[model samples]
Target: MSRLARLGLAVTLLFALAAPVRAQVKDDTPRNYGVGRVATPGQIAGWDIDVRPDGRGAPPGRGSVKDGEKVYLDKCAACHGEFGESAGRWPQLAQGKGTLASHDPVKTVGSYFPYLSSVFDYIRRSMPFGDAESLSNDELYAVTAYVLNLNDIVDDKFVLSKETWSRVKMPNQGGFFDDDREKTEKAFWNSNPCMKDCREPVKITGHAQAVDVTPDEKTQKRGVE
Candidate 1:
């Protein structure tokens, strides 16, 4: 089996073995460390981070859009712009409100995401590039609120907390539809595919006048291309 499959099997076996004693314990979820020992509470806390779409697993805390600006400038502005327009190759986090159907769509936290939990969860675990998981709960809340304010999803006075987190609606919340292709597209599978009569013969209609992706001949020799 693959590495992931093996690890999953190990976790399942461990959970089954330790479920009886730990079933009544309710502070946090149980975990297995793969070394024939149960993971400690501290270790479980580090990895037990995952916020759902309906805000079922959010932790208790609060932050405001006003307070979030400072956190954004200090920690996030170096990579993502002050207003969430990202630098050189970094990901943009704000704006892109109505460009989802445009030719050059800019997907940002405001325009593309469907869940507020995702915004909070991402920064909580994987933000600030080099310094990941360094922000405190309030700091993460503040930065998240600031990014939302940049996109106009929330006002400056709006406070983000576990209680009000799910109330903030994203523009694309209902943009995606549930997958029903298996039932609706049964005709496609019932009939045989027309390999010979699929479409007209392919033809090249355009060519690039000046473009080169291949490295220079000299650069190739040095293996630095």
Candidate 2:
């Protein structure tokens, strides 16, 4: 071999041998990345407030529809109508049966929400608009019951609690489905991963535009304010 070829081969061999030495070096100096202190149990509990779809993690409380109605009117009626039919630009909380596929879908608790625990979780954490997390546990239960009553799912006398939560099911309860991507789509992905050949560059196609669909800037700023 020529002198240039020999020098190139020697450098490549040195790199191939040095890679293992670098890999074997132990990084035992203890990286002190000052990434905040360890959180306390109480601090963790305050932020860890996620409720399950199966009625788990719900706080204990009871509230009657009668009380719920009062609470709804006093606190929720201003935005949500007297019967949960959103006022003005506010979102409608009830009604809208069988309108999911239509051009104008009116998603409400009665028509869209899948889980009842979601209602409890949402209201308890982010309800009464500006004054979120201000309502007591019992008051939140009442609010939930009242909303259910508006949808005619529960009677005016129904008293909702964490235990009886599972009993309250939305109309479109089974409308959803579990994703079967692993079984149905995994084969498509694993079947053909290699691309050995090239194709001609495709021409640009007509693009679609979404006009008059977005909310105005003013309305966006005052969201549920």
Candidate 3:
């Protein structure tokens, strides 16, 4: 071979020989990052506040509906209103029963939520809006109980605890059902979906401007001016 051809072959051979060495170095590199230590049991417990539908993760506490009313008035009344009827644009928590079938369905704690555990979990984790997780265990139970009372799910004399949580039946509990689409729709499902030319060429059917949802340039300019 000529000198130029021989030099090119040598350069190629050099790279081919070094590839295995580079792979070996990468293989010998340590896998352990050695940055974060294993979290302590106490640390894990602090963050493990998620309550299951079966009431598995709920903490031990009890609060009477009467006591819950006081707690609700102090912490929740400003936003949810004194009787859970809502204040201004805030959500209405109680008395939305039989409204789900209406044109404008009122989806509240009583009318739509399926599980009582969900209410407890939400209030315990995040409630009182700006001041979240500030309620004590007793206060948390009380507030939740009071909300249940407002919804007429539980009586005024009822005390909410982990034991009594199962007894508190929400009105719309029967409205929800487990998703069985996997089993039910398996026969209808297409295993291999079409990737190309799935339908006819695109056509402009309509514009969003026709719906008047989007503000026109003139309206935006007027607001700015």
Candidate 4:
């Protein structure tokens, strides 16, 4: 056999021999590191606080726009103005109905967000600037409803809960669609990449010396390219 063929056969034999050893070692090693216990249902519940668009995982709670306004004024008004107009550099949460297509579009809770669940999830996960996950379930629901009321999306009497969450439709709900780039942009894709001589041979059109960008050869250090 050729020297390269002999080397290849040796490598294959070595790998074949090591395969059983590797499998044995893997089987002998403990899969569990013995560091932490499996999470309790209560612990899992705490971490699984995400609210979905379809109202799945929503906590059983209710909050009225009026109650939300009170909570908003006390907890949220310092940053998001008295009526969700936004204070200083903070985000504006209301009054940008027809401004989306304009040059300076004010993307607030109402004008830009495609889902109410997203708003609820954001507030539930992180809100009041610093004290994240501090609000009660009712407060979270109320504050969310209040934001909707600020945008005129909900009436002052509207009470938001798991029951009514599905009834509320966001203004930009129809703006979002599933990603179809694979289907739409597949025609322009180049799967096979060229590595060698893929284009016309590159010719030296000019040199750095022609543009006077190169240092003087006399000043260049010896043995340096």
Candidate 5:
């Protein structure tokens, strides 16, 4: 081919490749969809509320179990029952004092939760369903005290405040342990194996049968099976 024609073909290919590069550079520009505004301190203070286990974020207030009982009856009894037994498919907040590892374990505030702060945090963040964060600090304290009283963990006259919050200990506090995978790894690696014929043959000894399989008189009268 001629030298000028070859040079023109090379220029055409270079422009075609550069067109995509230019289009990509244009598409990669920073986009701002009105979601990049900085938050003020007041805005942060309104939403940044979280309590720690060591009673770090407890608000300043107090409430006795007696006062909490009144609050529970007025505000919480409709869903949580008059005694925290749960209305329907809600949650039972009380009872289950010492039944953690049973076949039918009844896990409640008194039996399962390890920290009291979690209870307070949960109430503060979400409670009474539709009305969130409506309770005052003292009211939250009173409700927590009432729940503890209902769980049989504290006396009816016991007061719960920032000062006395950490004194209450749950029944299953010692049930949790830190993860020790290193020790577990050594134990698993050093164990002996029984790969050959380790399992024994099993036999079916008993079978389950329905006891109340009798049909009702109405079905018999209707000639329905």
Candidate 6:
């Protein structure tokens, strides 16, 4: 074959290869990562680990407060004291039942958490801090039951599981209200301007440096000021 024809064939082959490279260089568009294919039961079961406020995602296992107490002694008492009082810098998990609006509020699970599902989710995801996901479903339920019992929320024989999880009510459930962001945004946006006429001239009504430090005993002896 002629050299010209050979060069033309080689150029054609290079163009063919470059076509795919050009296609690959296009900008990345957004993709729906979880759109296709209905997840199998096993796959859904593996990642559906979120516990909802209504105890929607609780697993199939039962644990009583008694069982939870044993589990707490073995796995949790080192950090969260024997009765969930907290050992040192760790948080106290119990004994703060009715102090939400106090000047010094001591928030515990019984006093603060609005949902029992949140407590179970937190313990199942990250508790005992160092070890994560080390407890069985039954053990998690037991520990949660024990903690609730310690906080004087649940009865000693209360068993926690997916079926009974939603029935466990918290004390602070009615303390919070829905977000009123529309009113808040309108107030901030429509408020009057305060650039220069915000306040009156500063006045020094009192000064700690000019206070009289002399004893009042001589005034008492005189019986008059």
What TM-score do all the candidates reach, one by one? 0.70, 0.65, 0.70, 0.66, 0.65, 0.68
Q: C-alpha displacement of 170 in model 4, angstroms?
A: 0.6
The alpha-carbon deviation from the true structure for residue 215 of candidate 1, after best TM-score superposition, in angstroms, is 5.5
Better of 1 and 4 by TM-score: 1
TM-score, predicted candidate 1 vs. hidden true structure: 0.70
lDDT of 3 by residue, 1-225 (tens): 999999999999999988765443356666887889999999999999899878889898899999999999998999999999999999999988898999989988999988988898999888979888899989999989999999988888999999998898878878977899999888778888889999999999999878878866876545454
Q: How many Å off is the CA of 92 in candidate 2?
A: 0.4
Q: For candidate 4, write residues 7-84 as lDDT tens digits.
A: 999999999988765443346655776898889999999899898999998998999998999999999999989988
- lDDT winner between 4 and 5, please give it: 4
Pitting candidate 1 against candidate 6, the one with the higher TM-score is 1
Best by lDDT: 4
For candidate 1, write residues 1-225 as lDDT tens digits.
Answer: 999999999999999998776455455666664677778999987788888888776777888888889988998898898888999889998888788899989988899998888788888879877899888888888888889899999888999888887679988888889998998987778566776867888897866645556566877556466
Q: Roughly what TM-score does model 5 have, to 2 decimal places?
A: 0.65
- Ten-residue segment with the worst summed lDDT in candidate 3? 21-30
Evaluate candidate 4 by giving its C-alpha RMSD to the native, one decimal. 12.9
Residue runs of model 6 more than 4 Å from their true location after superposition:
1-39, 184-186, 201-225
Error of 5 at 147 (Å): 0.6
Q: Which pairs of residues clash in candidate 4, taking residues 3 or more apart in a chain or in different chains? A: none
- Candidate 1 vs candidate 2: the lDDT winner is 2
Estimate, for each residue in 51-114, the C-alpha lDDT of model 5 and write its tens digit: 8889888889999999998888988999888988889987788887657767878777887888
In every candidate, how many clashes are there?
0, 0, 0, 0, 0, 0
Candidate 6 Cα deviation (angstroms), residue 18: 27
Q: After superposition, how far is residue 150 of candidate 3 from its true place, in Å?
A: 0.6
lDDT of 2 at 74: 97
The local distance difference test score of model 1 is: 0.84
- Residue 38 of model 5, lDDT score: 98
